[model samples]
Target: MRESSSSFPPHNNTSNAIHKFWNTIKCCSSSSTSASFLFISLFICTLFFTQWSHYIYFPHSTSTTNSLQFSNWTTLSNNNISHDYPKKDGYVLNCSSSKALTITCPPNYPPSNRNHKNFPSNQTCPDYFRWIHEDLKPWKKEGITREMVESLKEKAHFRLVIVNGTAYVKEYMKAYQTRDVFTYWGVLQVLKLYPGALPDLDLVFQCHDKPSIMKKQYRGWRAFVFGSRDPPPQFHYCGGDSTFDIVFPDWSFWGWPEVNVKPWVPLEKDLAEGNTMKNWTSREPFAFWKGNLRNGPRPKLAKCNSVNKWNAQIIDQDWIKESREGFKDSDLSKQCVHRYKIYMEGNAWSVSEKYILACDSMSLLIDPKYYDFFTRSLVPMKHYWPVNTMRLCKSINFAINWGNNNTKKAQEIGKEGSKYIFEQIKIENVYDYMFHVLNEYAKLLKYKPTIPEGAVELCSDRFACSPMGLETTYKIETMVNGPSEQGPCELPPSYEPLTLKSIHDQNAKIKEQVLAWEKENYGWSWWTWW
Candidate 1:
């Protein structure tokens, strides 16, 4: 009972020595081991145990066991399923009861980029391409002619010509020159670039507008048709009665005087009161002529929330703001919309001719270039203040009477006219109306004589047909003859001669006045080779 308890404690020198030795050995080992080495050993052991535990717990997880496999798991719930337990790439075992479950990820398992599902940019033409092609092609084809073809030949020494002038004034000669026989002359009138003219002839096509003309000089000729349709008092029919093959006037007699007249508003009067003609006139004739004599002054930049003095204060602030905002970027779509609402001009011999030809329901004002510039799908409002009422009655279907000296009468007429226009004309239906008008114009073209007389019988059919026939004529003239011709000469019998003499008599007196005026003012005498 009293025997020594070995299991109990016994303080012995031998055991103490052994413990001290072991402690010293442990301290030495710890002191020799580096912190990084200790950390690495712990990390390796932890990783090994963690992997072993994961593999034991999740035996079905191939991704956990195989380092190569990686995946993303998405959980989906159904009415009967409380949790989805379908196996996936990195799925871990879980205990759950559910009637249905689905597990899915991208087919490749690891996605290359975050936004791979987005649609790519389109590199094809827009839906409107077909329509655009249809509309522009036919018109473009009308200008190809024999003269144009001959102009292509390098040794021919002939270049294709395009005379930008009043169609009525320049048509007779243009038609004559673009025929098959005149292939050597290589003349065609219209606004277009000839492929052959490049790098050599450098021929530039002509445009009626001054702005366009200034950019590139016309190849053949430049003439201005003068006189108005408003017979007597305002404008005398001079060229209408002339015998010359071509008779053109200066700036004075083209459109209604109101188009040139300053605004009647008090503010305009005040602005002009101290300004002299010399001060206001531009040094560039083209600019001055265009703004004052051709298309009215460029539409004042639409001011936001401000009054527009030029438009008679009729334009609403909202409208101005909208228009200005729309055109801020100068994009074609936006600019075209603004352009459609404004008036444009082309070349014309007389103010009356400009008005008659320029009147359009979609255009904001009338100008000589309306037909060419406005195109279709636009409505025109005319500047018809100074024009003769009788001529107005016969010519224009849509007009804006800016009022005569009698503002009240003008306002009344404008009100009635505007109402009629709003009811009868719409932007959508403009082309239909234009085609109808063209048909009517064609009838007049048929009855016209082949001679230059007055505005009534000048055989202006040439002008109307020239747009299409001119091209055909040029092609026949230039290309048909091939490159065999030795020299350029006038076309034979390409155009019919204008011969009605009665119409010419009416403007004889006016012609005398114009000739006298030219002599006195410019010190130039009237000369005609024909």
Candidate 2:
């Protein structure tokens, strides 16, 4: 998930932008008379045109909105629109209503994975599906209010409102590396796959890497805030310690092309088939890892790269080199030719963990501190061989040796891990996860959803137009072909208090057993975790 790259240059705010335009105008004009005329004309045109601005950007918040007004980019709110904002050919624009392009669902489209047989009345969803309930738990009792949402107006990146099956986003700031853009596209894809499933609701989404709505911070400690804001519904990619930030699926699920990874739809098959290409015994007998060594405890893991000693093959990933090769080397499916693959958190909970688990390699996952949407369901011994964070070299060694001694169990573990990821987290299941999350969250909204003041209606046509023009092809490829024949696999009932505690206790017990085995082989070392 951590990739090094040069950023596309930054654009200036209103005044500086207009000043830059004036400079260009003066440079183009032959005389002052022509320059004055051109300046007037350009300024008038700027007022009329609406340009959709997006890319990786930073520090755009409520504090900056008043000062950093759009000069080249128009503020896309409901109050100012008369007709569709037009731009140059090949570009798509969002309208209050789509007069130019009306999207009709199930457009005589190709066949999809609509279950023909009558699904059982008690068909239960996977365990990970239960996380949706926990994610929305904060808003369960009181329900989400307009005030609670507006509180995050200055804090969050975008306000997403889905009304009458149409989605719209009021962007407060730009997200890192088109994370916001692709995430919105993922949500839209969900709506397409499971039509009428996601209900109308206004939810504020925090686009930054870390969660912001801390429990202590929101408990009315600040004097300016109205009253106790116990918990505000702030949806984000990953969760933090004791935070109310709802964890949805990360953007990498769609694709991480910047790092040369394809979307999950194709990548799933690629990795699954890659498993068949090389059996576990046939694969290179080493604990393989190729990624940035700078995040979390990965730098320490790099030291364990002695193939003869630790049976570890670690690569200090060169993101630049991979990008240069058109990401040919970074295709994840090709990298599964090793018996054991390593997973380490990069910055926070990484998107790579899922891909690693799906590789059909015995995943030697270093005890993870942060988790994405699906990881909670993963049982330690069943899904992965837990490696100790404190003793990286010895721990990894023990795991490889243990697996080598117990080939049958190791192979079963590998297959089970991949089966969970490949079969369970397929494209259909991914959409189902999103649908249940959004649908349950919408049920918690106390107030009727409405289009926020500055939102542009986001449909497939409007969203496909990329300013960077990097992900257009990928987006088209990842889109759901048509509506599904069946509704989502039935979501199981929420776990009882004792049942949830038992599951947590079971995971801890498994980890403890692994550590005990490590201690018996090698002396227990003090944990200096990163």
Candidate 3:
């Protein structure tokens, strides 16, 4: 050390220290081994220092870009992030050590506001839409034209009552069984629509057993009745020309909710949209009809089906047997799979018009003698392809043949029909019509009503009268207007009436057979009594 200090002629101390460190490394390992290790260590140190220097100098870009590469790490940076979060498939993954419950709601569902108060506050009956008597059904343009509401206002009185006592109820029931009365459904419909009307009047509903109206007065007939049924020309025995003031549709076109029956067709919402048949050519080419063969021309209609050009399926539905085997109701919505659909009358006016027309399939409608509240508006070959009763089978064949050939026009007709019905005849709209009719009738009351003996008091709040199930089959005693005879009404020429002689003859035979059966079982006295 003393010799170095004299010989080193005042060199800097820092440089001397570095030179000594280098020489120490060389001496520890052989030259090749030491040099290779030393180069790797120095290169690693250089890379690390360079990266650290970039992070510090370009802090925002370098740090954020690298840190965000891990999604979990980024999520951890969020303050309110849930540990047990829902996955993309709607299931929650529990990430917590302690047990905690997590519920995932459907996408876009609003937070529950179940307890919030309604904006309008109290809702009342008067606040809803209603149909009027003057707004006639489309098919009855010429028929039922007399303004019933105005007529009632000029010459009617309101009487509502409940008939109690087992004897009186039984007496009315006897009348109903004998077909001397026929307004059960109509009366019930009115009550449901207007429970507050004539709350205290006592009256009964009566009509001829069959759909008949004649000049002959009814025997044992009360001066006042709640209502009567059947239209002119067809039902000559109705005898409602003068005595009955109220005339409601035989049964509502829509279903009764308490009864649990839905509309004749599938609900509009459940059905596929109009013109949904993408390839109409692939559908069953022939027309189709499936229903009970009990009414005017259905039996003859069954004879009309053919394998030739007028292709169709005409089945005679046995509803009774079908019920016994547990009703296997057809999927009405699937019926549109057929290219053509047929519409025919049942016993009287069926609620099927709306259903048949609503299907996207072209409707081959048979000429109907009777019209309901809404059929007048549709034009032939427009809403439906009309089939004549005069040449029953021929007309059906021709219509279907024409439809098959002119497919584009036929599809247009189907689409139009479905659109028209869906817009006009909803269940809610049907109730609106009931409300208006009842409201108008109430305005014509001659006397303020009071609850009668053995009668349950009803306001608009009640759905039906007391003895609900039992009374469905019995005569309901209520109030009515004093009887006054009106002359018979004449039907329009466009009815295209069918000769019901065969049907009448058949009914006569059945009546004769019934009388004979009674005579054999209970003697001549029972026959005479019946």
Best by lDDT: 2
- What does candidate 2 score on TM? 0.78
lDDT score for residue 101 of model 3? 17
Write model 2 residue lDDT over 238-273, tens digit each, in one string.
Answer: 886567889888887776555556678777777878
Query: Compared with the true structure, what per-residue lDDT tens digits does model 1 show for residues 485-518?
Result: 1211111221112322332343344334533433
lDDT, candidates in the order shown:
0.23, 0.71, 0.41
Give the alpha carbon lDDT tens digit for every residue of 363-473 in model 3: 877766545445645656567776656546656666677678888998898878887677766543444444344344434334443342332222211111211221211
* Candidate order by decreasing lDDT: 2, 3, 1
User: What is the model-wide C-alpha lDDT for candidate 3?
Assistant: 0.41
Query: All candidates: CA RMSD in angstroms?
Result: 33.6, 8.5, 32.0
**lDDT (Cα, 0-100) at 308 in candidate 3:** 79
Q: Against the hidden reference, what TM-scores do the models get?
A: 0.20, 0.78, 0.45
List residue ranges in candidate 3 displaced over 4 A: 1-266, 273-279, 450-530
In Å, residue 331's CA in model 1 sits off its true spot by 20
Q: Considering lDDT, which of the candidate structures 1 and 3 is the better prediction for this target?
A: 3
Worst 10 residues of 2 by lDDT: 72-81
